[model samples]
Target: MAKYKIWVVAAATLLLLAGCTSLPGTSSSSSSKATKKLQTTGKVTDSMYEGVIDNGQYKTSQTRGLTTQQSNTSFDVKSLESGLLKLSKEQFPTSKYVFQEGQSLKTAQAQKWLARKSKTNTEGLNPEDNGQKDPNKRNPIYLQQILEQDYLGEDGSMKGMSIGLGMNQVDYYTKEQYGATFETKISKAMMTQQGKQMANKVLSRMRQKKGLSDTIIVIGLYKQAPKDSLVGGTFFAYGVSKKGSTTIDSWHELNQENQVLPVVNDEKAINQDDATAFNSFKTQVETFFPNLSGVTAQTHYEEGVLAGMNITVNTQFYSETEIMSFTQYIATAADKYLPRNIPLDISITSAEGMQAYVGRASGSKGFTTHVFGSY
Candidate 1:
């Protein structure tokens, strides 16, 4: 039997409670420096869906399929343990999950996996036609088809993506003997400089406590292209399972409860020194995790900040050919219209060498972009 399967839309209503989930803001709305506001009215932003599932709509829809065995009900602690064991062993066989004596897998390892799965499952609730009108607004463009593939195991459960930004917050869902609830919040100041530091720290803690090994897919967006766009700087991450399975994924971590929010860096409000400081931190992350293929960065707008700047740096695997094409595109664009350091809100950067900074970082004859540390 297939290890993974897709759950139908009917599962949505049965699986989740009736509540509105605050999704990530994808629109690059125009906002002045002093006053910034998000584009709220249009399409429902963020990966999660709103309202209850429409059963009538599901039956009439030709696009989505209904899997009979899938169950949307919340899992109990016992079921969570069994399901997680099966999932962990099947999905990550090489890196076995080693449990400590007297520790409950459901409370720790299983809880982590389920929380991640719930986040991914929420993505299914979005009406299919959302981004059809505007393709550019779609998250992980060119990667959605991969997500359609089967990732969830059988036993009526779906798998969600768990990713975390290096900020101060951690978002997740859990149920104890008492009750079940979902949580999200910003990270503490001492955790990191700003943003979502709790995610990385939580993941680290999980790895040590539950023997969970993560293959991160990092995504970073920027207001302007760096010096190079090809090898080093373009920000995006892709996942390739060792079993040779490939999936389009977001830049997040499992330990962080898989909060799917775009990490938008505001550039207009900060000075060059501060921008460079952020870049330096990014460089450190890139250097630490050399396995990343390349990061895809888009020059998106931020409402309410000074013509605000938004940037992202992701971790994932990509073929060298794809990286080359992305890099060249950025370099060509930069050469045509050179955006100055200040008041510059552009995508990608110029390359000084023939290699990319993130991938192998080696190539003598091609132009390469700086992956991290260029602001």
Candidate 2:
């Protein structure tokens, strides 16, 4: 309790959350010119944001429908943006590069490329339909949406670009006209191959555009989890187009995973050690608090090693004193039971709203606690 930092929010009704989400972009590709400034942070968290010139205005992504274009699950949508940034760090380090919403691809061209490549729409990146309604004969949509992130130098010029291709792990469609819906299970192997092919096509298309002939592009292949999944998907592979080149030099495999805590079945493909720690943490925190509704966690891993976790604690908040005490107890339990080396966020909620938040960054020894008095 002495070491843990506490931030008490005194709002009576509205507890404003801190993170700033990337704003939706316009359909037109318009450039902006101003003084170049870099956005810096102490540590990169799940909610890292670019420093904006003004809070009310942000540089818009050139393409529209960023939120509506992809899977229904918010997990993959966030995964698409954060996963691409994490993978892009290999090529574009944060020390020198500044983050910005992409301003190159237009919404019209993006829509055209996302469509199937048919006689009328030759610009489509997807394959032509085989004129068959059969699931086996019909090609599954490997590409769901395209995400672009621009990196600029200290001078505000585009030094590099990161692209995320939101691929489908399972394509849900109807067999007949307004008939029963069916699922087309997409394998990771097929996704990998198709993603690479599509990445190259995207690069080629970009190179054809003006002022992009010599830009460096990093592409990440993300396989989104099904809409019903509790956790988001991970990036499977990534590649870098060398400077002034349109094609990727080589593809590198990225092994990242997200597993829900308190694994229900023995058949799950997650780490048992992480499961044990997470379960133990859950038991330690919720064991005495019978009033707590439920505790769940989404564990993230990199190459089989436990990386970080996002946990949710549900309850009915009746008193602020109760919240303060409960938050401290959970923070203590988290410190003793959870992995101390990785970052973790614990969000306390109730039927009313978010009651409090507790978080610890990677490599940090203490947790920062926030109790929202609005509840």
Give the C-alpha miss distance for residue 29 in model 2, angstroms.
Answer: 30
Which digits, one per residue and each the tens of the lDDT, describe model 1 over residues 326-366?
Answer: 44544444333222231221122234223333211111223
Query: Which candidate achieves the best TM-score against the true structure?
Result: 2
Each model's lDDT comes to 0.25, 0.70
Give lDDT tens digits, candidate 2, residues 263-316: 755657478777788889888877767788999887777778777778889987
lDDT accuracy of residue 215 in candidate 2: 88
Show where candidate 2 strays beyond 4 Å.
1-56, 63-70
Clashes of 2: 1
Q: Model 1 Cα displacement at 350 (Å)?
A: 23
Consecutive 10-residue window with the lowest summed lDDT within model 1 = 140-149
- lDDT for 190 (candidate 2): 86
